[model samples]
Target: MIWCFLTPVLGAVVAEQYLGRVKTILYSAAIYGGGLAILVLSSLPAVQETVISLPGLLLSLFLIGVGTGGIKANVSPLLAEQCTSPGQVIRLLKSGETVIIDRELTVQRVFATYFLFINAGCLAALASVEIEQSYGFSAAFAIPMTVFIIGFIALMTSKDQYNSSAPDGSIIPSVLHALGITIKHKGNLNCTRPALEPVESRYQEYPWTNSFIDDLQTALSASKVFLLYPFYWAAFSQLLTNFISQAATMQTHGIPNDILPYMNPITTLFLLPLLDRLIFPTVRNLGYPVHHFPRITAGFMVCALAMLYAAFFQRTIYVSPPCYDHPRSPTCMHGQVPNDVSVLLQVPAYILVASSECLASVAGLEYAYANAPKSMRSLIMALYLSTVSVGTFLAMAVLPLTVDPKITWMYIVLAMAVFGAGAALWSVPVQRKEAG
Candidate 1:
């Protein structure tokens, strides 16, 4: 289940206003890491009976949710905290800041964040299969705990690279004020607050429109940059999540059965550094800023093509039926075939998927942070991540509406990409003007 973005962004705003984002990330990471440990210890295994297992699974999900809430709520503010001035930020955006863009540094951060994902995923990918294959259920149950401890150690050793403070006074009131404005008008079909927190610290009277539709139209239409924005982030996230269950996975033939899931982790681990160090910088360096939308658009479309490859991979490649020991197996025809697709074809599909990830994922993060209002970095990041959650929910939700098989779940994702691309194109003119 998705949690709203407001909570963590609010926390970051308050803490940065009164405390600091560096401290926020430290505290955020701690709380999130703590939740990971809980999920590790308590999450139910595949064998657990439904009556006794559902609650634990839900609880584990809830704990992971807590960490997501914490990390996303503050990460943008934490990164932005490292910067000096707005003018310097603009220049740094073009030049590429050492903190965000250095090859070694980028690799390290990607390893820290993404490798953390892979290693954690390995619990499901490798350890579970391992436990099931060799040690049995209890060992699989225990694997996540071991992995969590490693994560804890990794987080503990990671240095505090971000060290900056709130500019002067409050970021709290504008955030709170924005929330109040949002909520007070939430049910009002036609209400709009023209005065979004003023440039000055003090609040000023803004134009409050009675028609919400008119106000929304004004915002998108008037804000040309956002209106014209391309569909890159929307498409990238949609593709990855839409095909979450599908992968170009190879078999663990002649090896222990339990380690098959580990293939994904291993493959991911090997590719991430290559991506961060070589592919990402090359793409970013090739006529960025001016060709920003097009670069990301190419990434989005490539990812779509990868999904098509995965679908084909799943369909083709003749997998022979399993030989049942039972003489009267009640026609176990489907059971005879391999549940997974062949690994020989999985490599290139994953390469395509991973490369697309490198092209768009982190670059988009940097892009969003660059575009946000000075004080609303964390909020924007939360919203950006929230789109992933929203896009996922939409995929499931649209199944009933389009009922046509031609318009499958992935089609919704494709459609969203198209919409986002249109929006981005519309918004670019305005954004460039604002930047200029």
Candidate 2:
């Protein structure tokens, strides 16, 4: 999983320096399809009986991770780049009120819609799980493999339709050079020393313009906003790990414990359109637009609330009958008898976390794209995506507390940590500047 997140950094550089977004996505899809094909073949009964299947499965997963990283880093920025308008435009509403359509708002809605489709696609997970259970692992793997083949064909037919940026020269050396210049000038980026100095007096010619410096500053400022994301992601990670474990301790009524996490995507599917079509428009019409930072802060708060609820829910499970405080007790047959609590009760927490994804996760994508320098969009996005890897590490650090008894404290700590991060985000001067 960490490799899945980290590979995007390299993928982004590849996208920026050599292959354009469309080609990168195509190549990545090809690699991903190959992995899926390998997976499907490896799951066949004959191969499953052999040691080769294990290595094949591992290799497939690694290839899939690499492909996923490449796709993730490029796709969102590609979508954003397709939007023609980059500035505000005045338009008349049906109600005869003239209003300014902000490109930032359009980007936000685009990302929200993008996220909606992503989750809709995630419904395949539930379907695949059922297929694996009923048909076979090979059949389950074959489904997505077939879908990817079709999707790749569609992309191939429509390749020229996308608005793609050509690979500019690599930005890494330029960024490093600019940073050195900034440090030499005692952190003053506005100085014209690069342009004004004689060529003979300097070790190298300044290849970047003054505008490039401005863009670099914007990218750096945007990077600062991403610092809080790891905490939010760390809290969100519980949905996959500890949340499933919590469900296992409760009465699932013959349902799979892992199935409940799908509620996050299910709730997101319902909420995205409502937020995009209704809530945001209504709030904007009321003269209070929820900008990206406040919207993300709201997401952080929602995540914290989910954690708080989970903490209380964990406490309830601990105090519930049969196992009482220790669900794994041998007296209760070592988790054979779960607590009397119904697993359906976990739905609200999942819903809250889903809401946070709509708010924080989608908005973070929009923020990254909108604020990034045109040339560095993929790089900035990869940095934003890396937060998930960092958050995974944070979750791993707390794995010791994921066991019974300590789990409740884990939730509490996560809640406090996320809320504190959100508060810090809100207090950021740039957030205030944007809000004002």
Over the stretch 29-80, how does candidate 2's per-residue lDDT look in tens digits?
A: 8888899999999999899999999999999999999898899999999998
- Top candidate by TM-score: 2
Lowest-scoring 10 consecutive residues by lDDT in candidate 1?
Answer: 320-329
For residues 1-436, what per-residue lDDT tens digits would candidate 1 score against the true structure?
Answer: 3453334644555454754555555565565556555454444455364454556556656655655566666654465445444342222554675433333243234323644464456445554765657876556656655665676577567645455546324444544444455567664323234434434523555433334334333333323433222333343343334333332122434443333334445655666666556764575578443233443455565666665665455444223223222211245443333334445565565566555554445444554555555555555555555555454454455445332123244444554554455445534543321210
For each of the candidates, give the backbone clash count: 21, 0
Root-mean-square deviation of each candidate, in angstroms? Answer: 8.5, 2.9
Q: How close is candidate 2 to the true structure, as a TM-score?
A: 0.92
TM-scores across all candidates? Answer: 0.60, 0.92
Model 2 error, position 358 (Å): 0.7
Badly placed stretches (over 4 Å) of model 1 are 1-19, 26-30, 33-37, 40-57, 76-80, 83-162, 167-292, 311-335, 338-343, 397-436
